[model samples]
Target: MPIQKVTRDEILQKALGVFKRQGYHRTTMDDLARACGLLKGSFYYYFDSKETLMKEVLWWVNRTSEQRIFSVAYQHELPPDERLGLFLDRLYAAVLVSEGGCIMGNTVLETAMITDEFKEPMLVFFTNWTNAVAHIYETAYPTAQALKLAQQLAAEIEGSLLLVKLGSPESLLRDCRERAINRLNVPMHDCTSNP
Candidate 1:
C-alpha cells in the first residue's frame, strides 16, 4: 500500500479538532495521527511531539481567527455596527457554535496551569480578541469604558460557549450577538445575519 501524504496545515487543523474536543492532556499522538489519517509513527516525520503539534495548532488557530474574525474590528472603512456585527457573526461561525467551541479558550483551561509551552500563543489569541473587541467599544465610550465593555463582552461570549458545550441551544449565542449589537443601539431588525 502507498503511504498517505498530508500537509503540515492539514495535520495542524485535524490536530486542533481533536485537541479542542479532548484537550491537550487527554489527546494522544495516536489520536492526532488517526484524525489526520496517518499512522501513529508518521507524526514524528511532521511534529516532534504532541506538545509541538499543540503549539502549532494554537498558532494556527490564532492566525486564522486573527485574519478572519479579529481583523474585522480593525477595518476602519466599515461602519462601527457593521464591523462589530460582522465580527460577532464570524466569531460565532468560526468558534462559538462549533462542536468543541473555541480551541484557544478550551486549550487555555486545560494546559495553561500545567505547562508554559502553550501560554504565549494562547495569550496572544485572547489579547488580540480583547483588543479587537475593545476597538469596537471605543467608538461609543471613552477609552477606559471601552476596555471594560470589551472585557464584559468577552466574558459573556465565553460563558455562552460553555453553555454550548453543555448541549445548550445555539440561541444563547444568538442572544449574545444580539445583545452585542443592541448595545451599540443598532435596531433589532438589523441583526439578520447569523452564521
Candidate 2:
C-alpha cells in the first residue's frame, strides 16, 4: 500500500470548509482531522493545538482572499464600477453566497468577544477588504469619503449576509452591490472649489 502525504495547503483548504460549516468553537480537532483524512494525533503533527490551527486558518483565508478577491480592486485598467462588480462577484463566490457564508465574519462573531486569540489575523482580513474597497471608491470620491463609504459598505454587507442566512431576500445583497457600484458610477463632486 502507498502512503498518502498531504501538504499543509491541502489540509488548510479542506479544513476551511469544515470551519466554515461548523465555526471555531463548535468544530473539534477530531472533526478537522477527519476532514483532512488524518487521525486526531496526526492532525497534531500539523498543528500543535486547535487554536493554532484556527489562527493559521484565519490567516490562510486572509491570504487567499487577498489573492483571489481583494486584488480585483487594484486592477488599474478596469473602471471602478467594473472592478467593484468583479470584487463583489468574487466575494460572493468565495464566502457571501457559499453555504457557510463568510468564515471570517462568522469566526469574529463567535470568537472576538470572548477571546482575543483570533483578533489579529481576522483584522487583517477585514482591514484588507476595506482598503481594497476604498481603493475602488477612491477612483471617484475623495480619500476620506472613499474610506468612509468603504467602511459603511463593508458593515452593511456583513450584516446583510446574516440577514440573508436568516431567510431575508437575496435582493438585500443585490441592493448592497447596486448601491455601492452606483455610488462609484457617478462622478466625484468637489466641495472645495468650482460652482
Candidate 3:
C-alpha cells in the first residue's frame, strides 16, 4: 500500500479535538502532540509554536464552518424564514460534527485576556458570518433592518449552543429556534404583517 501522507491538516485536526474538550488555556502542546501520536520535537517540526498552531486551527475551523453555513444558506429556494431554519439545522449539525463548539466563540471565551491575535480573528469571523446571514435575512426583510435581526439571531444561536454544550440541555436549542422563528417572521416595518 502507498504510504499515507501525514499532513499538517491531519495534525491540526487531532489538536482541535484536545483544544475543543479542554479549552485553549487548559490544553497544552504536549497534549496536542500526544493526541496526534507524535513526539513533542516532531510536532515542533510542523508548528513553530502553540500560538501558531492555534492560529491555524482557528482559520481551518472558520473556513470549514463558512462553507457549511454558506452551502445550507444557498441550497434552499424556499422563503427566507424556512431557509433560515434549514440553515440553523445545518449549522448545528456542522458544529456537532466538527466537535469544536463554535470555534470562534470558543477561542474568544478562552483567550480574551491572553492575546489580541485570537480576539481579532474571532471578531472578523463573527462579523463575516453575521453579515452573510444578514444577507439572507435581507431577502425577506428590508435591508436596513436585516443587520440588527441577523446580529441578534446569531447571538442567540451561539449562546444557545454554548448552553447546550455546557449543560447538555437539548431544550435550550429548541427554545432558541422557536424564538428566532418568532422574531424573524415579524415584518421589519410592521410586527402584525403575518397576522
State which candidate has the highest TM-score.
2
TM-score-based ranking: 2, 1, 3
- Tens-place lDDT per residue, model 3, 125-156, is 77877777777777657765677777887788
Off by over 4 Å in 2: 1-4, 190-195
Between 1 and 2, whose lDDT is larger? 2
Q: What is candidate 1's lDDT per residue for 1-195, written digit by digit as tens?
A: 234798999888888888878888889888888888888877799999888888888899899999999999999999888999999999888884445898887877787788888899988988899899879877766666667767788889888898878988889988888887666663334323331
Query: What TM-score would you give candidate 2 relative to the actual structure?
Result: 0.92
Q: Which of the two candidates, 1 or 3, achieves a greater lDDT against the reference?
A: 1
Badly placed stretches (over 4 Å) of model 3 are: 1-5, 98-100, 191-195
- Taking all chains together, the TM-score of candidate 1 against the true structure is 0.90
Q: Per-candidate TM vs. native?
A: 0.90, 0.92, 0.84
lDDT of 3: 0.74
Residue pairs whose backbone atoms clash in candidate 2 = none
Error of 2 at 153 (Å): 0.8
Q: Which pairs of residues collide in model 3?
A: none
As for model 3, its CA RMSD to the true structure in angstroms is 3.5
lDDT of 2 by residue, 166-195 (tens): 899879988989998888756666522321
